[model samples]
Target chain A: MRTIRVELGERSYPIHIGSGLLKNIGAYCQEAGFALRSPLLVVSDSTVAPLYLPQVEEALRSQGYQVVTHIFPAGEASKSLAVYEDVMTTAIQGGLDRHSAILALGGGVVGDLAGYVAATYMRGIGFMQIPTTILAHDSSVGGKVAVNHPLAKNMIGAFYQPAMVVYDLDTLLTLPPRQVSSGLAEAIKHGLITDEVFAYWCREHAEELLALDLEALGYALELGCSIKAKVVGNDERENGLRAVLNLGHTIGHAIEAVGGYGVFLHGEAIAIGMAGSALLAAKLGRDRAIYEETVSMLTALSLPIRLPEQYSEDDLMEAMKHDKKFKEGKMTFIIPEAIGSVSIVNDIDEQLVREVLAQLKKEDNPW
Target chain B: MRTIRVELGERSYPIHIGSGLLKNIGAYCQEAGFALRSPLLVVSDSTVAPLYLPQVEEALRSQGYQVVTHIFPAGEASKSLAVYEDVMTTAIQGGLDRHSAILALGGGVVGDLAGYVAATYMRGIGFMQIPTTILAHDSSVGGKVAVNHPLAKNMIGAFYQPAMVVYDLDTLLTLPPRQVSSGLAEAIKHGLITDEVFAYWCREHAEELLALDLEALGYALELGCSIKAKVVGNDERENGLRAVLNLGHTIGHAIEAVGGYGVFLHGEAIAIGMAGSALLAAKLGRDRAIYEETVSMLTALSLPIRLPEQYSEDDLMEAMKHDKKFKEGKMTFIIPEAIGSVSIVNDIDEQLVREVLAQLKKEDNPW
Candidate 1:
């Protein structure tokens, strides 16, 4: 078992990663200082619940902790206020107290939604992130829990940290190939943003990671979580330094929004955005090698580096304008200076972004 | 103007109280360091909007702030998730950026609804409290912002502090006599729990406060805000010391719920709960003068000290069971030790609370 602590002072908590940890969830809860007297609410999505909910409940109940379960349909659409309200209703009906904790038992969507439920329920309660998917390696580590609004993704949320994060790697054995690639995109992002060696390591071990090699996958997740935890700990509210973590997010969110959040997974969209950022860096007269290397890394993991031809540049630009990163009619892009390094550049030219989008949409590789 | 600062380390902010302060709101915004580049959203209810929103918008506009206004229907019913979502829609549609500020421009309902919006919008933006009612003196300063759920009041909310609180004494002139009494309930509560002298002063100057004498009201509000700010500063998340701020909230919230939150205003219900707390303290072997003095103070301000006969004791107890303060099937009551001191007592006998309720509902004065 490997444990990484997110150093947020009083709000600090640990992320425990290992095999078959779900069966010992009760012991984890006890070690994490969760009281048995208070009832616990386990929020899961339909896909993850059928597989793991019974084991989680049995473990908690065996430890004399009252357990209540709330399962919503599995998808990005479930990350809405209406679904958040449903989970809140279950929490209220379940008689969960202020001390009671809400455990997220699925992937990124479930983690985001349940973390948000904990953030606002009774003006913030105890929350534990139990990430089941590889993509959640990014979402669950940071305290940025939110439900998407009709107008935009993650428009409504809070920076409420969790009590702990229990990552049971055994759950990842069930993920399909597409989801696995999607999840690894963020793991690769961690390396692309700060760790040069890890970036090359991820690309080198792409097959092992994709083939569900436990040792390789475990090492990647731990490194990714550590990089994310360091960034989040320094700037919890994204005042300045934290913006670097959004290297691909500015353009990435736009891609996700333009694709209606369904056509592409969040990690897939971000992978393309990272590719776009590298291209944008080259357009701004940075080294062209940045673009080549980013695309190479993403492609090695079977992640797409091109936008679907159907999405128009104008629509993508419109979506970027609605993003939280867009300010005063100016786009803020986390432009890559080189591999494992980035700089936050404000007021990037719209025409340059459009040019990059056009190039990305080409049927052939621009490189 | 009188300023009392809530010392919350980096989150600390000032409460500005005086006559005609709204006319100079633009100056306050500038002094508090609100940026002119980002647009500002003002959230008001129909009633307060008609009275002050125009002047506020004009003031902000004069200071080069691009202002947008969102007004919902007036009253407690407006503080629901639906209205909260409506305000969020208006905020998004208004093109509010991360740096933009949200000004809560009404009483507690508007402040709570708007503050919750700010707390969650783009993972929180800048928020300022512009209070237009005497009741807001209590609500605005403490940063306890929330909207009610169908199942409960303040069930969904956050302890998000505002940039500053602007209390314009002129707005209090428009309040009706019943509102004057309702608002004073909290002011008297602040004094009762912390300062014996202030509590007696509130009783002594009841007529001046009700008559809208700006001098007396100003002094009273400053004192009340200071008391609250001190308590809130010491304990921001209600881990321990802050629970005393709920002097009458346990019983007060129960009464409000049983009455469907419409029959009595929040302060009025709390007034009766204060009376009930005094009775409970007496039953627990405290001085009988505590009950008499409390009833005398409430009556002096035209606040009710008795629950209406329509509410059954059983119904009130059931409501208490659902309160956030109720834990492990035990009631946590802020019991008065004397006229100006209180203590948080947990696991109080339910039957004893029932007796207090029965006594409070009687036609005759139990004291």
Candidate 2:
């Protein structure tokens, strides 16, 4: 087992990476100072619920925790205000209190929604994250929990920290090939904006990581989480360095909304958005080679490397404008100056961005 | 103008109390460090928007702020999830950004809803409070922002602080008599849990305070705010010391939910809950005299001294059980040991609570 700590002063917590960690939740819970806290609310969604809920429930039960499990429908669509309210209602109904903590045991949707519930329930409560996807390897560690607004993805949310994140590699075995690909896309972004060496390594081991080679995927998540930890630790609110972590997310989020949520998976959308960001960077960034490398690596991983035909350049640009991160008429993009380094540029030329979108669409070999 | 600083480390903010302060929002904004942030979003409800919106917008416009104003309907009904979503959707439409700050310009409903939107929007942006009611003098200062869930009031919310709280006593002039009484009920609560002298002063000057006596209401708000500041400063979350501030709010929140929201005003319902707390304290508390005085003071102020006829003892008890504050069938009640001091007792006797409810209903002269 390897432990990586994401530091944010008093809000700091650790991310545990290992196999069969879910079966040993008792030890982890005790180490996280959740000794004898009963009636643990284990929250998951429909897809994840059937796969790993019973194992998690029985594991906690062996530790003598009266676990209350709740399963909402699984999907990005579940990250809505109505669903958020329903989760809180579930917390109240389950008799959760300040002392009784929440254990979110699923992917990003469960982690984000449940962490948010912990953040605001009875003002706040302690929560443990058992992230079930490669996507949550990024989402769960950072404690950026929020629900999506219809007009914008993740428009309403908070920078709430969790007590600990238990990334049980055992759960990864059950994920579909597409889910693995989607999660790895975010892991690739983590490497691009922070570590050039890690980015190249992800390209080198793309097949091994995608095939869920236990050691290779574990190393990728660790590298990804470490870079994110430093970014989150320095700027939890995305004020400065933290914005770099959102490299491909600006266009990524827009297309996802344009794609009507579930049509394009979060990771797939972000992968396409990264392609546009690289194109924007190719024109404005210092290192054209880094931009070329990013495009090549994404293509190698079988991730979408261009905007889909359904979305017009005009529509994608409009979707980007709706992001709150865009100030006035200017949208800030995390321009890759080098493989491991990035630049936050606010004076993004609109004509140049439109041109990049046009060129990205012209590409015939994105997949 | 008197500015009372509510100290909570870096989250500290000022509560500006005076007459006609709303007219000079630019100066207040500068003081709160929002001098040049533009495209200010001024949020309000229908009742307050009609009365004060133009003036506030004009004031910001004079200071060179490109102000955009949004308003919802004026009742407690507007504090629903639907309305909260609508407010965020409005922010998207208005193009609010990280650099842009939200200026909440109304009573508790507006303050709570707008502050919540600001708290969650883009993972938080700066927000100012332009409280326009006597009730707001209490709500705005504490930085507790949330919307109501149908199953529970304030069940889904966050303990987010405001950049500045501008309390213009001039706005209180427009409030109806019931609103004045409703606001004072909270002021009286602040005094009871923290300061005996302030509580006694409330008893002595109930009529003057209710009539919106300029100096009296000003002093009342300042004192109430100071007590709240100290409480909130010490405990940002309602863990231990902070729960005392919710002296009457346990049963208080229940009866409000039982009364179908609009039936009994928040403070009016809290008054009834306070009466129940006092009766419970008379039997279980050491300071019997304090309990008697509280009942008399509430009755003197034209606040409800009994639970409404629609809710039975069983119904009220069931409602109380729903409170997460109560752990393991044991409800924690903030019982006043005297006017100036209170203790958090968790092992609340259920039979005694029932008997007190019975006695409260027996009192005929509630008004």
Q: How close is candidate 1 to the true structure, as a TM-score?
A: 0.99
Q: Which parts of model 1 have CA positions greater than 4 angstroms off?
A: none
| Fnat of model 1, as a fraction | 0.69
DockQ of each: 0.80, 0.66
Write candidate 1's Cα lDDT for A1-367 as tens digits.
9999999998899999999999999998998787788889999999999999999999999989999899999999999989988998888888888888999999999999999999999999889999999999999998999998888889999998989999999999999999999999999999988999999999999999999999999999999999999999999999988888887887788888887876798888999999899989998999999998999999999999988889899989888877899887688999989899989999899999999999888767764
Q: Pick the candidate with the highest TM-score.
A: 1
Candidate 1's docking class is medium
In candidate 1, clashing pairs total 0
Tens digits of per-residue lDDT for model 1 on B57-127? 99999888999899999999999888888888888888898988899999999899999999999999999
What is the alpha-carbon lDDT for the whole of candidate 1?
0.91
True contacts kept of each: 0.69, 0.73
lDDT of each: 0.91, 0.83
